[model samples]
Target: MLNFVEYTTQSALRNAGMRSVISFGIALLFFAATLVSFQVTDASAQSACFERTALMKHLSGKFEEAPVAAGLAANGSVLEVFSSPDGVTWTIVLTQPNGATCVMASGESWMGMKKPKKDKVS
Candidate 1:
Protein backbone atom coordinates (compact mmCIF):
# COMPACT_ATOMS: atom_id res chain seq x y z
CA MET A 1 0.00 0.00 0.00
CA LEU A 2 2.84 2.43 0.88
CA ASN A 3 4.57 1.76 -2.46
CA PHE A 4 1.39 2.39 -4.42
CA VAL A 5 0.71 5.65 -2.63
CA GLU A 6 4.28 6.89 -3.22
CA TYR A 7 4.14 5.95 -6.92
CA THR A 8 0.85 7.89 -7.39
CA THR A 9 2.24 11.00 -5.70
CA GLN A 10 5.41 10.91 -7.80
CA SER A 11 3.40 10.53 -11.01
CA ALA A 12 1.19 13.47 -10.09
CA LEU A 13 4.20 15.70 -9.43
CA ARG A 14 5.83 14.75 -12.73
CA ASN A 15 2.65 15.57 -14.63
CA ALA A 16 2.39 18.92 -12.92
CA GLY A 17 6.01 19.72 -13.82
CA MET A 18 5.44 18.84 -17.44
CA ARG A 19 2.35 21.02 -17.60
CA SER A 20 4.27 23.97 -16.15
CA VAL A 21 7.04 23.63 -18.71
CA ILE A 22 4.55 23.49 -21.58
CA SER A 23 2.75 26.53 -20.28
CA PHE A 24 6.03 28.43 -20.08
CA GLY A 25 6.95 27.45 -23.63
CA ILE A 26 3.61 28.64 -24.93
CA ALA A 27 4.02 31.96 -23.14
CA LEU A 28 7.44 32.43 -24.72
CA LEU A 29 6.05 31.69 -28.17
CA PHE A 30 3.30 34.25 -27.68
CA PHE A 31 5.79 36.87 -26.58
CA ALA A 32 8.06 36.23 -29.57
CA ALA A 33 5.10 36.50 -31.96
CA THR A 34 4.06 39.78 -30.43
CA LEU A 35 7.58 41.23 -30.89
CA VAL A 36 7.81 40.12 -34.53
CA SER A 37 4.44 41.58 -35.37
CA PHE A 38 5.37 44.89 -33.78
CA GLN A 39 8.59 45.02 -35.77
CA VAL A 40 6.78 44.35 -39.05
CA THR A 41 4.18 47.01 -38.38
CA ASP A 42 6.78 49.56 -37.34
CA ALA A 43 8.93 48.98 -40.43
CA SER A 44 5.97 49.48 -42.75
CA ALA A 45 4.79 52.60 -40.95
CA GLN A 46 8.00 54.63 -41.32
CA SER A 47 8.40 57.16 -44.16
CA ALA A 48 11.15 56.86 -46.76
CA CYS A 49 12.03 60.52 -46.40
CA PHE A 50 12.90 59.93 -42.77
CA GLU A 51 15.70 57.53 -43.65
CA ARG A 52 18.77 58.54 -41.62
CA THR A 53 21.37 58.45 -44.39
CA ALA A 54 19.19 60.32 -46.85
CA LEU A 55 18.31 62.95 -44.30
CA MET A 56 21.97 63.46 -43.36
CA LYS A 57 22.98 63.80 -46.98
CA HIS A 58 20.15 66.20 -47.76
CA LEU A 59 21.09 68.37 -44.77
CA SER A 60 24.85 68.27 -45.44
CA GLY A 61 25.31 71.34 -47.61
CA LYS A 62 25.33 75.05 -47.06
CA PHE A 63 22.08 76.91 -46.46
CA GLU A 64 21.29 80.58 -46.91
CA GLU A 65 21.42 82.00 -43.40
CA ALA A 66 18.47 84.39 -43.87
CA PRO A 67 16.01 81.65 -44.81
CA VAL A 68 17.42 78.63 -43.06
CA ALA A 69 16.24 78.41 -39.49
CA ALA A 70 17.00 76.35 -36.39
CA GLY A 71 14.89 75.39 -33.44
CA LEU A 72 14.78 73.40 -30.24
CA ALA A 73 13.66 69.80 -30.41
CA ALA A 74 10.89 68.41 -28.25
CA ASN A 75 13.53 66.68 -26.18
CA GLY A 76 15.28 69.99 -25.54
CA SER A 77 18.02 69.57 -28.11
CA VAL A 78 19.01 72.59 -30.21
CA LEU A 79 19.73 72.75 -33.94
CA GLU A 80 21.92 75.69 -34.95
CA VAL A 81 24.51 76.93 -37.42
CA PHE A 82 27.74 78.91 -37.40
CA SER A 83 29.66 80.46 -40.28
CA SER A 84 32.95 82.24 -40.70
CA PRO A 85 32.88 85.99 -41.30
CA ASP A 86 33.65 85.52 -44.99
CA GLY A 87 30.75 83.04 -45.18
CA VAL A 88 32.90 80.70 -47.23
CA THR A 89 32.78 77.95 -44.61
CA TRP A 90 29.89 76.75 -42.45
CA THR A 91 29.34 74.47 -39.50
CA ILE A 92 26.04 73.03 -38.42
CA VAL A 93 25.81 72.41 -34.70
CA LEU A 94 23.53 70.42 -32.48
CA THR A 95 23.49 71.49 -28.85
CA GLN A 96 21.61 69.54 -26.27
CA PRO A 97 19.82 71.64 -23.72
CA ASN A 98 22.02 69.96 -21.15
CA GLY A 99 24.99 72.00 -22.47
CA ALA A 100 26.52 69.41 -24.77
CA THR A 101 27.32 70.65 -28.29
CA CYS A 102 28.30 68.73 -31.39
CA VAL A 103 28.99 69.50 -35.01
CA MET A 104 26.48 67.82 -37.28
CA ALA A 105 27.98 68.90 -40.60
CA SER A 106 30.37 71.36 -42.17
CA GLY A 107 31.19 72.51 -45.67
CA GLU A 108 32.87 75.17 -47.77
CA SER A 109 31.18 78.01 -49.70
CA TRP A 110 28.50 78.74 -47.12
CA MET A 111 26.64 81.98 -47.71
CA GLY A 112 25.38 84.30 -45.00
CA MET A 113 22.77 86.90 -45.80
CA LYS A 114 21.11 89.76 -44.05
CA LYS A 115 17.44 89.45 -43.29
CA PRO A 116 15.24 91.24 -45.83
CA LYS A 117 13.83 94.46 -44.46
CA LYS A 118 10.06 94.69 -44.34
CA ASP A 119 8.36 97.61 -46.06
CA LYS A 120 7.07 100.30 -43.70
CA VAL A 121 3.41 99.85 -42.77
CA SER A 122 1.20 102.36 -44.59
Candidate 2:
Protein backbone atom coordinates (compact mmCIF):
# COMPACT_ATOMS: atom_id res chain seq x y z
CA MET A 1 0.00 0.00 0.00
CA LEU A 2 2.79 2.43 0.83
CA ASN A 3 4.50 1.85 -2.54
CA PHE A 4 1.23 2.26 -4.40
CA VAL A 5 0.59 5.71 -2.86
CA GLU A 6 4.14 6.83 -3.65
CA TYR A 7 3.79 5.90 -7.25
CA THR A 8 0.46 7.71 -7.53
CA THR A 9 2.00 10.90 -6.12
CA GLN A 10 4.76 10.85 -8.71
CA SER A 11 2.28 10.31 -11.51
CA ALA A 12 0.21 13.31 -10.37
CA LEU A 13 3.27 15.52 -10.39
CA ARG A 14 4.13 14.46 -13.90
CA ASN A 15 0.62 15.15 -15.11
CA ALA A 16 0.66 18.61 -13.50
CA GLY A 17 3.89 19.42 -15.28
CA MET A 18 2.42 18.40 -18.62
CA ARG A 19 -0.66 20.50 -18.04
CA SER A 20 1.46 23.51 -17.15
CA VAL A 21 3.44 23.18 -20.37
CA ILE A 22 0.28 23.03 -22.42
CA SER A 23 -1.09 26.15 -20.75
CA PHE A 24 2.15 27.96 -21.46
CA GLY A 25 1.96 27.01 -25.11
CA ILE A 26 -1.57 28.34 -25.41
CA ALA A 27 -0.53 31.60 -23.77
CA LEU A 28 2.32 31.99 -26.22
CA LEU A 29 0.01 31.44 -29.16
CA PHE A 30 -2.40 34.11 -27.90
CA PHE A 31 0.43 36.59 -27.41
CA ALA A 32 1.68 36.01 -30.93
CA ALA A 33 -1.79 36.56 -32.35
CA THR A 34 -2.19 39.82 -30.46
CA LEU A 35 1.14 41.08 -31.74
CA VAL A 36 0.24 40.24 -35.33
CA SER A 37 -3.11 42.02 -35.07
CA PHE A 38 -1.48 45.15 -33.71
CA GLN A 39 1.05 45.23 -36.52
CA VAL A 40 -1.66 44.84 -39.13
CA THR A 41 -3.72 47.66 -37.65
CA ASP A 42 -0.74 50.02 -37.58
CA ALA A 43 0.21 49.28 -41.17
CA SER A 44 -3.33 49.78 -42.44
CA ALA A 45 -3.73 53.13 -40.72
CA GLN A 46 -0.51 54.47 -42.19
CA SER A 47 -1.33 53.26 -45.70
CA ALA A 48 -4.85 54.75 -45.70
CA CYS A 49 -5.49 57.71 -47.96
CA PHE A 50 -6.66 60.11 -45.26
CA GLU A 51 -4.36 60.57 -42.31
CA ARG A 52 -6.84 62.80 -40.48
CA THR A 53 -10.11 64.67 -41.04
CA ALA A 54 -10.68 68.37 -40.36
CA LEU A 55 -13.19 71.16 -40.83
CA MET A 56 -11.92 74.44 -42.30
CA LYS A 57 -13.47 77.84 -42.83
CA HIS A 58 -12.61 79.83 -45.92
CA LEU A 59 -10.96 82.98 -44.60
CA SER A 60 -10.42 84.66 -47.93
CA GLY A 61 -9.77 84.04 -51.62
CA LYS A 62 -7.63 80.92 -51.06
CA PHE A 63 -6.91 80.74 -47.37
CA GLU A 64 -8.25 78.63 -44.55
CA GLU A 65 -7.18 78.19 -40.95
CA ALA A 66 -7.73 75.67 -38.21
CA PRO A 67 -6.29 74.94 -34.81
CA VAL A 68 -5.03 71.55 -35.82
CA ALA A 69 -4.33 69.95 -39.18
CA ALA A 70 -1.45 67.74 -38.23
CA GLY A 71 -1.84 65.17 -41.01
CA LEU A 72 -3.66 67.28 -43.57
CA ALA A 73 -1.95 67.35 -46.92
CA ALA A 74 -2.47 69.95 -49.66
CA ASN A 75 -4.94 67.60 -51.33
CA GLY A 76 -6.78 65.98 -48.44
CA SER A 77 -10.54 65.72 -48.41
CA VAL A 78 -12.44 68.70 -47.00
CA LEU A 79 -14.85 66.89 -44.74
CA GLU A 80 -16.43 69.97 -43.19
CA VAL A 81 -16.24 73.78 -43.46
CA PHE A 82 -16.91 76.49 -40.92
CA SER A 83 -16.17 80.24 -40.84
CA SER A 84 -15.92 82.84 -38.11
CA PRO A 85 -14.50 86.33 -37.92
CA ASP A 86 -13.58 86.05 -34.23
CA GLY A 87 -12.48 82.41 -34.68
CA VAL A 88 -14.77 81.50 -31.80
CA THR A 89 -18.30 81.53 -33.18
CA TRP A 90 -18.15 79.76 -36.51
CA THR A 91 -20.85 79.57 -39.16
CA ILE A 92 -21.15 76.65 -41.50
CA VAL A 93 -21.46 77.97 -45.02
CA LEU A 94 -20.53 76.94 -48.54
CA THR A 95 -18.35 79.28 -50.60
CA GLN A 96 -17.51 79.22 -54.30
CA PRO A 97 -14.07 79.35 -55.84
CA ASN A 98 -12.88 81.86 -58.45
CA GLY A 99 -9.91 80.25 -60.22
CA ALA A 100 -8.80 76.81 -61.33
CA THR A 101 -8.93 74.96 -58.02
CA CYS A 102 -6.83 72.00 -58.90
CA VAL A 103 -5.89 69.35 -56.39
CA MET A 104 -3.80 71.97 -54.55
CA ALA A 105 -4.02 70.29 -51.19
CA SER A 106 -1.84 67.41 -52.29
CA GLY A 107 1.88 67.27 -51.33
CA GLU A 108 1.37 70.37 -49.14
CA SER A 109 0.55 70.25 -45.46
CA TRP A 110 -2.27 72.66 -44.66
CA MET A 111 -3.96 73.86 -41.51
CA GLY A 112 -7.10 75.78 -42.51
CA MET A 113 -8.15 75.05 -46.10
CA LYS A 114 -11.27 75.51 -48.11
CA LYS A 115 -13.55 72.54 -48.45
CA PRO A 116 -12.49 70.40 -51.38
CA LYS A 117 -14.80 69.81 -54.29
CA LYS A 118 -14.68 66.85 -56.61
CA ASP A 119 -13.46 67.60 -60.10
CA LYS A 120 -15.71 66.80 -63.03
CA VAL A 121 -12.87 65.76 -65.29
CA SER A 122 -11.35 63.40 -62.81
Q: List the residue pairs that clash in candidate 1.
A: none
RMSD of each predicted structure: 12.8, 13.7
Backbone clashes counted, model 2: 7
Q: Candidate 1: which stretches are off by over 4 Å?
A: 50-122
lDDT of 1 by residue, 1-122 (tens): 56998999999999999999999999999999999999999987753333333334544543433215578889998776765556666767676766656656767887666888898979
Instruction: Summarize candidate 2's per-residue lDDT along 6-66 as a digit string, tens digits.
Output: 9999999999999999999999999999999999999766521221232232333234433
Local error of candidate 2 at 110, Å? Answer: 32
lDDT of 1: 0.68
lDDT of 1 at 85: 54
lDDT of each: 0.68, 0.47
Task: List the lowest-lDDT window of 10 residues for candidate 2.
Answer: 94-103
- Candidate 2: lDDT over CA atoms? 0.47
